[model samples]
Target: MTDNTNNTPDGIQKFSMNYSERELECTVEKEGNILHLHIDNNINADLEIQQDGSLIQTSGPELPPSNIDFIRKHVLGQDAKGSVVATSGE
Candidate 1:
């Protein structure tokens, strides 16, 4: 079987954050300028790049404004088929 634990497939990447009580894990896949995000393996969202370079959540989980902003700034701009990126918080 292919090892996907460390090596993510093309057009796919992963990120994570840690908290006192829980952890947040996310997977992002890019198709053109559109990003498909899966958060905590439960929340799924689609972030689209607009003509003005703004990011918008087109579908999926109702995330807080701050969460949306975070995804837009950090997750959406990455090259999905490149490498896996991760983040941690305490």
Candidate 2:
């Protein structure tokens, strides 16, 4: 019998984070200049790239400003597609 495996799409990746002693597992998808953060199988953040290489949360959960900034710095401008800017629980 044939079985259906994980149905993740192309250009998408999954990873986890350690935030304040909490483990946050999620996926990341890159589209245009935005890195979409998915958590619990749902899109959590649509981080928009700014001119200065910073990212702004256009939608999804209202992440704390510090958490947003932390992720922004981790996102390499030239290799954003390969880089992930994970968030924190708090």
User: Where does the lowest 10-residue lDDT sum fall in candidate 2?
Assistant: 1-10
Q: Indicate the TM-score of model 1.
A: 0.60
Off by over 4 Å in 2: 1-10, 19-21, 73-90
Q: Indicate which candidate wins on TM-score.
A: 1
lDDT of 1 at 68: 55
Assess each prediction's global lDDT (C-alpha) against the native: 0.57, 0.53
For 1-90, candidate 2 gives per-residue lDDT tens digits of 211111122256655655445666757676656767776665377776655455667778666665555444443323332222434432
Tens digits of per-residue lDDT for model 1 on 7-76? 3223877777542246798788877667788878777777665544455667775555556555555654
- What C-alpha lDDT does candidate 1 achieve relative to the native structure? 0.57
Give me the displacement of residue 14 in model 1, in angstroms. 0.9
Minimal lDDT window, size 10, model 1? 81-90
Q: How much is 86 displaced in model 2, in angstroms?
A: 14
- Prediction RMSDs, each to the true structure: 11.0, 11.1
